[model samples]
Target: MPSTDDLKLRIEAAIPGSSAAVTDLTGTGDHFRATVVAPEFAELSRIEQHRRVYAVFGADIGGPIHALSLVTKAEA
Candidate 1:
């Protein structure tokens, strides 16, 4: 089970200049909701933005990370 801080670090590391806020939706560490803001998302579609975020976790999505709900935004 990955900690929320760990997940936030991974996301921020994976995407340069990005800010991620990860929360454990459940008491367990498997389910999460991440709100990410990045300049890279400016030109991408919502789906594409999500895909980029999801790519950071790779195989962990359905394995260690049972569920991840994402809310992404382009940097202001």
Candidate 2:
């Protein structure tokens, strides 16, 4: 299971000039919610922004990380 800080760092690292806040939705560490703000998202649609974030995790979305809820925003 990935830690919240780990997820945050991964998201930030994967998307340059991005900030991410990750929280474990459940105590189990498998469920998470993340809010990511990035300049890269500025021109992307909501689904595409989400897809970019999801791509960072790959198979981990269904494996070690059970669920991840995302709130993404373009940097203003």
Candidate 3:
């Protein structure tokens, strides 16, 4: 199970100029909710933005990480 800070770092690293706030929604370190704000999301659709963040986790999603709820926003 990945920690919230680990998830945050991975997201920020994967998406340049992005900020991620990761919460352990279930307190188990496996369920998480991430609020990601990125300049890269400015032109992308919501699905696309989610895809970008999900890509950072790759096979980890649904594996070590049980569930990840996401809220993505384009940076103003």
Candidate 4:
């Protein structure tokens, strides 16, 4: 089964120096919640920050991965 490792790697690749925490919201691969902190997020608005992370998966938002509740912040 595809695990968080795959998602983590993808996010890490999409945004370098980023750290993420993934939670299975429904015990299914679709619904998820992620807290992502990255140095690259500095100066970005909250909505923009979330968009950047969401864009990583492209159209997979409603496919392999479904709902992604994001808590994104710039790294301190």
Candidate 5:
């Protein structure tokens, strides 16, 4: 199981100019809620921005992280 810090790193690396706040939604380490802010998300649609964030985890999304709740925003 990946730690929340690990998840935050992966997202920050994947999303341009992005930072993340991750919460463990479950004790199993398979569920999380992440608040991500990035400049790359500025022009993106909500779903598209979400997809970009989701793309970071790839297979880990459903495996090590079963559920990922994402909150994406542009860098203000």
Candidate 6:
């Protein structure tokens, strides 16, 4: 049961120069929605950007994290 702040911190730490706003969609700590902005995403495709974020969590994505919905953007 990860907190929103924890998820945000993990995403930011995993992706250098990135910021994440994470919300616990169900208040259960299993589902989340994250909007992340990063300079690194500027060159990557949407799928690639998502993959980068998801890679940070690995197996925990399905085990403890349940589902993570994402909206990613390149830094402007």
Off by over 4 Å in 2: none
- Give lDDT tens digits, candidate 3, residues 44-73: 999999999999999999899999999999
lDDT of 5 by residue, 1-76 (tens): 8889999999988776899999998877888999999997889999999999899989887887899998889974
The model with the greater lDDT, 4 or 5, is 5
Q: Number of the top candidate by lDDT?
A: 1
Candidate 1 local lDDT, 1-76, one digit each (tens): 8999999999999998999999999979999999999999999999999999999999999999999999999974
* lDDT agreement with native, every candidate: 0.96, 0.94, 0.94, 0.84, 0.89, 0.95
Write candidate 4's Cα lDDT for 1-76 as tens digits. 3467777778888898999888788887778888899997897999899999999989888878868889998974
Residue clash pairs of candidate 4: none
- By TM-score, is 1 or 5 better? 1
When 4 and 5 are scored with TM-score, the better candidate is: 5
Q: Candidate 6, which segments miss by more than 4 Å at Cα?
A: none
lDDT by residue for model 2 (1-76), tens: 6999999999989999999999899889999999999998999999999999999999999999999999999964
TM match of model 3 to true structure:
0.96
Q: What lDDT score goes with residue 54 in model 2? A: 97
Give the better candidate number (3 or 5) by lDDT.
Answer: 3
The TM-score that candidate 4 achieves is: 0.89
Weakest 10 consecutive residues of candidate 1 by summed lDDT: 67-76
RMSD each, Å: 0.8, 0.9, 0.8, 1.4, 1.1, 0.8
Q: For model 4, give the 10-residue run with minimal summed lDDT.
A: 1-10
TM-score of candidate 1 relative to the true fold: 0.97
